[model samples]
Target: MSSKVSLLISIILHAGVAFAQGPAFERTPLFILEKNRNPENIMVIYTQLDSECRVQKKRGGSEKVVFDFYWLMKRKDFKQVNPIIKKEIRSRLELLPSNDTHSFSVMMNDLKELDTDIKDFKLIVTANKKKGNCVTESILKLGESDQNKKVKLESIYAESKGFLIPTVISVTVNGIDAETGAKVTRKYMKK
Candidate 1:
């Protein structure tokens, strides 16, 4: 039909336009988790992958995302956390700019994956079991009717043994192929 042909042409044109505009690197905050007791400490995750060329210009960089972890602490003070530990492990990765303990930026790349080298990494919750209102990664599509709905983070389990540990978060990302329109997803876990 003529309508179908017009739609196909439109898609081709849009694809061409997108191609003409160089790679648009962007970061989209997809999920997060907060410490059980300390509200000031939270792990924010971004699902967008910054390309190799974009990251390694100055030096070597981390490429792929690997594992989700939590830095367990008994006290609210993060000054005790080591700065070198963030990127010391050859095959590990964690948030960087060591000065900021409150909100850490994920420092990673694509070719090589990253893992958070936390000694006592644990899960705060999941879809079924939850210690408190926590976070994990899930690829989801927003339905037309659900677009405006807001999901609330509720804390049901309030009891902690005086230890303020962050909620367990997982590593996962989703994308769509520019050429094929097929959906793509990647997740990394420890052996």
Candidate 2:
């Protein structure tokens, strides 16, 4: 076989392997309050709804929202993943009958206490309900240099996506707002 043929065969095999590994996971961004501040030490905010408490407008019913927040760090080998700052909120959904969706901002508090000097890590937020589980994950890259950046929070929506079926629960991690800061409380009403 010629040298060119062998090279082409090797390239094809590598491409196949890459495709088999699967596409990258989508990440939501966490807004950092101050520039040049350490991402781990600073306050980061994202929006999420109560997993149990969602208003299914199309279908009239009750929804249960359970919020679970975890911090996933890729180990040195890159294959191993570990969880940190694992918190489970037992709060129930304050339901509203007439609303189509429920949205709110969630603040990630007490990150400095983790005690691990990780330059970067992934934030995974999971909402579990009677219908199904919904998850929103984001990667936070904290480098050694002071980049002096501020992260802004934006609204995100989750849908049941079924015609006859109602959404069990939907949580939107609205991005952090530097001006308003983390919301202390939110109210949901019923139809």
Candidate 3:
């Protein structure tokens, strides 16, 4: 066979292999909200649990990877937070088109329309206060009506230092507040 024929065959076989694999997402998270382990003090999502997802839909046949860039921060590193958040957002927005990843971003805060991307898609968060031993529970769903609601994937936490232990972070969402800016706010007991 000619060299050209052999090269074409090689390319076809490589393409087939690539197509077989799918997009990759890590169980590792850039950051996490953890419950205080003290038995006396239970964990309650003080103000509200904001759950927002920034989705980058798959394109073509490329199996993209979840974007998980790790970094460290000191308390003083961020003097004014809004500016920082905005700058970070702007940077990421520019890079989104260049990324070969199928990633989602979780954002929060009282910026009013800070997180309405999923408003039409919608997610319901229930912040049930802890009672006796029942413990506080939270649920996340997509869509407004129960018929349209879809359960999210079971989330696993990622830890380092001690180990890359997978941890699950749960937050209760009372509702999605378009006006208040605080979506899924919970009442926590302090005593």
Clashing pairs in 1: 62-108, 62-109, 63-109, 63-110, 64-109, 64-110
Q: Pick the candidate with the highest TM-score.
A: 1
Candidate 3: Cα lDDT at 47: 15
Query: Each prediction's TM-score against the native?
Result: 0.24, 0.20, 0.21
- Model 2: how far is 154 from its true place, Å? 8.6
lDDT tens digits, residues 1-191, model 1? 36643443333223321211112233322233333456445332232323321221112454433223223232122132344533342223343332221122333322122242322221111111124211222322312333322222111111123323322233443344333545444343322
The clash number for model 2 is 19
Arrange candidates by TM-score, descending: 1, 3, 2
At residue 70, give the lDDT of candidate 1.
29
Please write out the lDDT profile of model 2 over residues 1-191, one tens digit for every residue. 56643442332222211111011221212222221212222222223333342311222443422223222211011111123212112112111122233332233322222333324333333222333533232222222332312223232222223344333233232333233343221111121
lDDT of each: 0.29, 0.26, 0.26
Query: Model 3, 138: alpha-carbon shift in Å?
Result: 17
- Candidate 3, 135: how far from true, in Å? 35
When summed lDDT is taken over every stretch of 10 residues in candidate 3, the lowest stretch is 41-50
Q: Residues 76-138, candidate 3, lDDT per residue (tens digit)?
A: 111222455335433422222224122332333212222222343221222221231111111
